[model samples]
Each structure stands twice: as C-alpha cells, then as structure tokens.
Target: MNFRNPVRRALVAALGALTVLGASSLHAQEIKERNLRFAFSLAKEHPLGVGAQKFADAVAQKSGGKMKVTLFPNAVLGSDPQNLSAVRGGTLDFTSMATGLVASIDKRFMVFDLPFLFNDAKEAYAIADGPVGKGLLDDLSAHGVIGLGIWDLGFRNMTNSKRPITKAEDLQGLKIRVIASPIFIDLFTTLGANPVPMTFGEVYGALESKAIDGQDNPVAVIESAKFAEVQKYLSLTRHVYTGMPFMMSKKTWDSMSDAERNVIRAAAEEAKQEERKVTAAKEGQSVETLKKSMQVNEVSPAEVARLREKVQPVTDKFSKEVGDATFQQVSAELARLRTASK
Candidate 1:
C-alpha cells in the first residue's frame, strides 16, 4: 500500500534517516576511546582493589570498550603521596587513599580522621553520603581532583609486637606508626605513644625491624599486608573508622564529555556499594584469620570510653583546625543520626 503512494514512502524514508543521524550524533557526543590508570597502595585482593577492578570493568562495559581503566595496586605506581601528586598533576587518572592522607591535600578532610568520630560504618556512611560529605567533596575542585564518592575501609584496630592494649594506658610508650597526618600524630601523642608518621608501604619493614612497635589499620589491611607474621598482638580497638575517598584527576575529568562523566560517576557509585559489601563480609574473616597467628584481644567498652576521653583534647584541637563550621556541621549530623537511632 505504501509502495503505491510516493508521498507515504518518502515520509517513512525521511523518518528513518533522521533516526540514524540522531543516533550517530549521540554516540559521537558521549563515547570516546580512552585509557585510564588507577593506582592505590593495597594488594589486588584487598576490598579497595576489588572495588577498583569493578569500576574498571563497569567503565569498559558502559562505554562499550571505548574506555579502559587500568588498575595499579600495591603502590606499583608509587606511594600514596607520589600517586596523589601525579593525580593532581594529571599524570595519573585516579587514586584512593585513607582520608587521613588526603588531609594533607586539604586539612578539612581531617574531620573524618578525628578519633572516635564514628561508631560504625552506618554512621560513617550517613556522614559521607549525606550533605556535609558532598559539600566537602565539592570543595576539592580547587585542589584539582574530582571527588567521586567515599568507599568503606571499615573501623581501624591496633596491632603491635608489644603486649596487648587492654586500656588507654597500655598504649603508652609504644612507637606506633600512623598515617602522615597531624591529627594522628597528635592523637597518638596525647595517648602517650610515640607516633611515627609513616607511609603504608614502609610500615611492614618498620614493624619487622622493630622500628615501630605497633600500627593501627583496618583488619582487612592488616590481613592483606600480612602484619600477623611480624606483629604479635591484635587489639580490636575500633577507635577510628577509615573511609577511602575515590577520586579522579580534575584535568582528566574536565576533558571528558558529559556522557563519559556519567559513565564514570555511575560506575564509581556501583563499585562503592560493592566495595562496602565486600569489606563488611571480609572484616570478620580477616580477624579470624589473624587470630591464628596473633594474640587477638577485645578492648572492653569501659576502657574504650577512657580511651575516648583521653583523646578528647586531640579532637578539640583538630575541631578548630578543620574549621569550626565544618567540625560543627559533622557533629550536628552525628548527633541527629544517633538520636534518631535511639
């Protein structure tokens, strides 16, 4: 019937041609061949490493193989500091490090590193994925990095070659390695332990040689890094919750088309959820694995309360350093979450 009508046939042909042109235009705007390097200071089997690979796979699939994200784990690219500099300079495309290390780039991030700031991952996630966290992340545009989203690293515990830390006083006189950040240094100092600001890569050697008596990190890190071989004690202090801030070089981000950015942002969000799930599941297993080789002990709630009291000064000091407004904002948010839960 259409073949019998030239006008009807022409209308159908025009519509089909327009559809093809539109698709071609959309593809040209959104897809491009790209190779990106993502580096971090953890083994491939670590939760963060697992998340990075998930992100890479999602990116490749989302872009239909137009974009490739290469992962460099275990500090193969460089230490966290070196990688941070490279990312800022645009030589590296992405990296994630402890929020404490990120504090060096912007001290405001120190708010997250405050001792005993978070009781668990649920509270931490609320602070990170909520308004205050997004605001702090948005502020990173000035530092030449695009803050994607915070991935969970879980609560940090203490390990040492010395006796178990049953109370705050037990930590006294221990040479504990800490992230190269002021709050950590002050926190350990206030607790009477000699704080050694060190990079994650140097920690194993330092502990093995007895240069440092102890170090605190999430169980996943301690297990993945095999600290159990050299450290004799594992104290489940859960004193601080560490969040991995996944970021992109602003230069790389600015160069992307809207479509490319969308793919990246979505991939990061999905990978973040996956990372948190894996991290939570692995923590208990890591502790169980560690118990086989280390004298693991749980710090009682009463002692933990005393530990929190001892570090109050350090928290107060950093509350001013990170800016009263930023500090107060987080405190208010935490209060609300706690109240609602009760």
Candidate 2:
C-alpha cells in the first residue's frame, strides 16, 4: 500500500472542512452587524440617489457583509443644510451635499460654483480631481465632516414660465426660484431676475402655485423632477457648474478602523466616477425629453456669453465675500484648464 495516497486524501478533507468553518464564521458575523445610513437631497431616481445606492452596495460587498449602508433620499432626514448639521452632530453617518450648501459653512467652497467656470464635465473633473479638489476636501475636515470625493451634479440651466430667456433682458423681473444660497441669489439678482431662495423640496410647489415664475437647474434634474410640467421654457444657460461632495461624520470616521476607512474611501471614489458617467448620459438625453412637453430653447453661444457678462458683477461681489486670494486661484485654475483644452 502506498502511504502517499492516504496522506493526500486526508489533507484534502481537512482543507475542505476549514473552508466550510471559515464561511460559517463569516455568516454568523454578518448576522450581528449594523447598517450605516446615507442621507442625500434628491429623489431615489436622481443621480445622487443612484450613486449613494451604488456606494452602499460597494461598501456592503467590500466589508463581506460585516458593514451595510442604507440610503435616505429626497431630504427624508432634512434639507441639505439640516442633514449636514446632523452629520456634524453625529446624528447622521453620511451625506452627499452640494457645494452651494457647504459654502455656507466655508465660503471658499463657493469657488467651485463660480459662474461659467467649467465648460464641460471633463474640464470640471480635471480640476476637481487634482490639487484644487483635495484642498477643498481638506477644508471640510475642519467643519467636522470628512470629505471623501466630488460627484457631478451637471451644468446648471435656467427655466422660466413667464417668458423664454433667449437673452439677458428676458430675465428681468422674473421671479426665479433658487437654492437657499446667497451666491445664487446674488447671481440671479445681478442678471435682473428676482431670486427667491427656497429649499429644493418646496420648488415644485412654488412653481406649480405660481409663487415662483421660474427656476434654474441641470437639464437632467429639470426632467427628472418634472419641472417641465410646471414651467414652460428651458434655457441652456449652463451658467454654473455644480458639484456634490461625499462626506462622512468626523466622529463616525474617527471611530472606524484604518482598514474600514480605506475601504469606504475607495468605494466613494468609485461611486463618484459612476455618478459622472450617469450624469453625462442623462444630460445628453434630457433636453430631448423636456422638448416633448415643454418649450425648450438652446441659448446661442453668443447669448451664453452675454449672460456671463451679465453675471460678472455677481462674481465680483462673491469674490470679495469669499476672499480675493481664493477667487484668483479658482480663476487661474479655470484659465489653465481652458488653455490646456485648446
């Protein structure tokens, strides 16, 4: 009898048993885990919500079922500012928030919202994924939030029911609903429109009740939120570049192990890339979708330039409030990107 055959069989049987035992241990661990909650200010069908879900899925898979993330979309917990406060207070674990809202905490964030700063998604991502973006993220850490990465919110457009905004003059006297951000209010006011600062949740009702004659948002957002049904004109202004910052509570982040932090950070970055792709595709199709039900007008390049000129004063005012050094840095970055693109 060859003893080699029996030895090999015994080794194989022991290995199989170890594998089964390890898997059973993992299963037991998963059953005793707690889920993390992610809050965002968009409907479940919106890009941010979709990205949040993707992040949750990645976290759950990467943690091997030991950690999970649940999404609270459409301001379920509160508005952007409120949710951010909750995250800071450790009442909320995570949130995907617009830079506009974050700017209220640190005015430097307004640099990202500069009008006509980023021409397209690629240019935006280039600056955002580089030094400038990292600096902004680091800035948020001082506010009790750990910024993970930047996600796309698409180019901002103008929508109105009073009249088609083909030229700058058309914006005169129209009450446009804007996010509750001073920068946005100043931008619309400088463009001759009366800006009504309101929460995102109240916009649709405001538009429907004629409390606001118009509002501005990305084409994808306008279509997804069905703003077309409440408004008549869609102006391809592309005035502002919006970005959503992925953030976690500093307390929660500090409590996590280094391995867990690394995993969550990696998942957030992957989700950001996915968000940009989804937003780009949705923006390409949204205009056509809106045209089916509403009067859609693509502002000519010359008109966009004219609009830019009209809002220059707003930028000037914001630069003073946001600090000259930061504004200059952002302007320099935009110029460099444009030159390099050409």
Candidate 3:
C-alpha cells in the first residue's frame, strides 16, 4: 500500500543483479563439456596441424577448459575421404581437407582445383573471403557438412624422382602420384604424365619404394613430408591454388549450444589466419631446405604457360559440371581483383 515492503524490494533488486550476471556469463549449463576429435591427413608440423592446434587451444581457453579438441593428424583417424565420411556419419566431429578431395563428395568443390584459377594468395583470399568462397562453404550444409571457412593450402608444386621439370614436356612419361581426383588425373595425363591416383597417407612409402615416380604438393608439404629424402627434384610448378576447408559434421554441430558454436566459428577463423602465416613464413625456407637434399627448379613462365594450356580441357569439362554460372561468377571476381591491383 503506502510503501512496498523491504523484503519485496530486496527480492526484486537481487533478481535484477542475478539476471545481469547470467547474461554476461559464458559458462552456460546448456553447454555440456565435450572431448571432440578433429582429424587431418597432414603431419603434426604441417600448417594444417598448426592451425588445428590453434583452434583446439582457443576452444579450450574460451570454454574455460570445459570443451577440448583432440587432433588426430597424419591420417591416424583415417584418410581425408574416410574422415569426411566419418564426420557425415557422426562418428567424427570435424576434419580439414583440400577442396579438391571434397569435390568427390560434390563436384562443385572442384572449382577450387581448376588450373591457374588464382594467380596469388591475395587474389585467392579475396575470392574466398568474399561471396564466392562463402557461397561454396554454404553449399555444404545440404550434404550434412558445415564449412567453418577456407584456409590456405598454398600454391601446389611438383616433386619427383625424375629430372627437374624445365618445361611442360618434362612431365611426359613420368609416373606421377596424384590425389585420387578427376582433375588431377586429367591434368597430369593431358601433360603426358602417367597419373597414379593414391591416398596421401600412402604417398611416402610409394615414393620411397619407387612405386611412383613423383607427386605434386605445396612447398611446405614437400618439406614437411620429407619427400626430399626419397625424391630428387622439386619443380616450382605452382600449378594450382588449393584451399583447405574446415568442415564440421551437422550432427556434431547440432549437439552444441549457440555459445559453443560461436566460440568454434571464431576459433576457426583465427586459426585460418594463423595457418596462412605459417605457410607463408615457411614457403621460402622450405625451398631452401629442400635444395640442400633435393634438386629444386623453377619452371619458366613459358613452360608454365604451356602447362596451363595443356590443362585447359580438364578445366573446361569441369566448368560445365561446376555450372557455368558459378564458374563465371568467380572468374569475374578474379578479373576484378587483378584489374584493381593493376
């Protein structure tokens, strides 16, 4: 009546304070602690591992050590294809793989593998951070995968036991190991190399045994995999700009609260930046390190042009499969980036 009872006023004040505290608190009971597993086929020292470790550390720190990610690098969990399948089936939480490998799951991903698609890392990042890249990631949800974002895989180069690649014709008759993908097979064959598709996990042993003549990969990968130990040459072919995408299982995603999901997404983005830095830092040193043990050569611009011309048919076939409109959209964006730089 006259004045509200002190007990009633005190109760309201206490409730208001509690509401403020709860709103600001990150540790909501709705977020259950989990031991999540993340898998990749690359070595622990590789950029993929560096970024994955960064993600795991960020998640643990942000979650107040409630949720922790255990990384299974070097295909301990399974090969890229197998890990992808496990994530889709809810047996695994997440995995990172080349978009080229994921193209097997959906041909749209092959667009990233198109030869000479990106002239440099800046152009690639612009496309990936822009609508074109995000649109591709967004496309994964329909297939039970959620792409956190794309990370740099760096430009790919060729390494082999054969002579240094001075020209496109140097690839002729060489038995090259390639990712078990249509574009890789078609690309190598068009350049006159015998393509042998194989899982990355098997590459080292195959090369060591001389079962395969050579393989192509990024500079960091060539050094990290110690291919220099068995392979005699590294050709700076820089044939493709590969992007590594972090994919999550929709089932695993559905199990997390909005808070946990936000932490994960942010952590992935941060890790992406970290991975690219590591790759860039190691790029020059990787070549130097490989040269100490293996013959390293840079293909001439003329040779690269010939190689590009040879792979055009493979890109053309996939252009239709990737849908002409999507390809045109990205191509237009790439042109804009180059024009602006000019």
TM-scores, all models, native as reference: 0.95, 0.90, 0.94
Provide the overall lDDT of each model, using Cα atoms, as 2-decimal numbers: 0.93, 0.85, 0.89
Error of 3 at 115 (Å): 0.8
* Number of the predicted model whose TM-score against the real structure is largest: 1
Span of ten consecutive residues with least summed lDDT in model 1: 24-33
Ordered by TM-score, highest first, the candidates read 1, 3, 2
Q: TM-score of predicted model 2?
A: 0.90
What C-alpha lDDT does candidate 2 achieve relative to the native structure? 0.85
Lowest lDDT 10-residue stretch of candidate 3: 23-32
Alpha-carbon deviation at 341 in model 2, angstroms: 2.5
Residue 112 lDDT, candidate 2, scale 0-100: 75
**Candidate 3, residue 241: how far the Cα is off, in Å:** 1.2
**Model 3: which residue pairs collide?**
none
**lDDT against true structure, model 3:** 0.89
Residues 75-189 of candidate 3 have per-residue lDDT tens digits of 9978999999999898999899988898887787788899988888988888788897898898888888999998888999998897999898888899999998898898899
